[model samples]
Target: MPESELGGPEEKSYTAPGKVPLDSGWVDVPRLSLSASAGPGAFGGEERPFDNFRFSQRWLREQGLDGSHLSAITVEGDSMEPLLRAGDEVLVDHSPQPFRDGIHVVRLEDTLLVKRVAAQGGGRYSLLSQNLAYPPLEVNAQDIEIVGRVVWKSGRL
Candidate 1:
């Protein structure tokens, strides 16, 4: 038999199997999402794959994202609903640079919010809400922190 074919149909590691796992960590500019999908029926004994619980801590570490310069968190609140649905995912860029007028994941005194940020300057900016019921806000440099700019947004299609 050919060596390749002799390797248990070329897929299964039936003999002396090895195990490897994934580790994910969030650091600066965290707009990471852990999404999972599954089929309706069972074709074989295999289980459906789950979404990423966390990104590779090693990857983030090697890339230096775990430092104070970057961070990522799940979004909450309905303020950014129309453009950023409650469950949709976002990536934050925390390098502290000028962002073109758009949305961002802002962190204030005890709260983390995802809102549309219209840049003002010198650590100040305007927060606009897609929902008119909630009025826009003008924030000062000290009032809040820019965790990261929203780099991307994704959701169910």
Candidate 2:
């Protein structure tokens, strides 16, 4: 057998078997310790990165996500059910752009929440839930801080 065909000294494995190599065109985004509530829950006063999730760089670019501004947070309720479920991990973009009417993660009174926000045309937003059991929450735009926009979500089937 030739040297190239054999387990040659020049060839080295950068990662374990069945794992993606570091230079394999994948990027890691931090999974934050914060949880975005779909119901009523308060977040502890710590913003730490717990772990990282690997995603294809090409795919992220296609989705128009900036890797530097991307982070993941876990969902903690069923208010956005059928679209976002409890324990679902969602990708957030922290870019400071004009807010559009869409699903977003917001911080209100120290609680982080994920809800569909509709522009009420008077510096007010209506927070809506997919589950009809929860009523829509209306708030003045100045009260809540928009943490980020939910760009993607993943959950176990």
Candidate 3:
């Protein structure tokens, strides 16, 4: 990854894959995408917000996700910072694909950590913190349970 793709605390040296480094001076996060974005009201149609109840219960269930397949968990901490602030609502894709290097809510050991996935190191994985104050934490695969991938973060604009 390019130097710009990597970021973290000034005191930590986290050499993880797909890591977006956070520094005291690097506070500006832009709209980054691997592909071009669809502009508002111009991508054939406007994007619609997910109706939590129907989207999570009936629709998603009808789409093949059983009752045990999903749940709405209110985010409770600032460990995720700007990307996933406390009180924000995030839809957890319970029936998620195999753990990959991306964002996900993970229950490692006894702690539930909502951090950006960094790498899958055979028996362990690296979790990146959006806030520089919190250094990256390494958790063992066996000790961690993959909750789900964070589909989208919704909150006040």
Predicted structure with the largest lDDT when compared to the true one? 2
Best by TM-score: 2
List model 1 lDDT by residue over 1-157, tens digit each: 3233454554442323222221113322323332110111111222232233244557756655444454334545566667665556665557757567777666556455667778787777887777677777888968877656765556665
| Tens digits of lDDT, candidate 2, 116-151 | 989998899999998888999999999999999999
What TM-scores do the predictions have? Answer: 0.52, 0.84, 0.55
Clashes of 3: 6
In candidate 3, what residue range of length 10 has the lowest lDDT sum?
Answer: 33-42
Alpha-carbon local distance difference test for all models: 0.53, 0.85, 0.53
lDDT score at residue 7, model 2, on the 0-100 scale: 59
Better of 2 and 3 by TM-score: 2
Ranking by lDDT: 2, 3, 1
Encode model 3's per-residue lDDT on 1-157: one tens digit a residue. 3344455444455446433334322211122111110111011122232333323244444555443454444455566677766666665567746667777767655455567877766787887877777777777777767767766556676
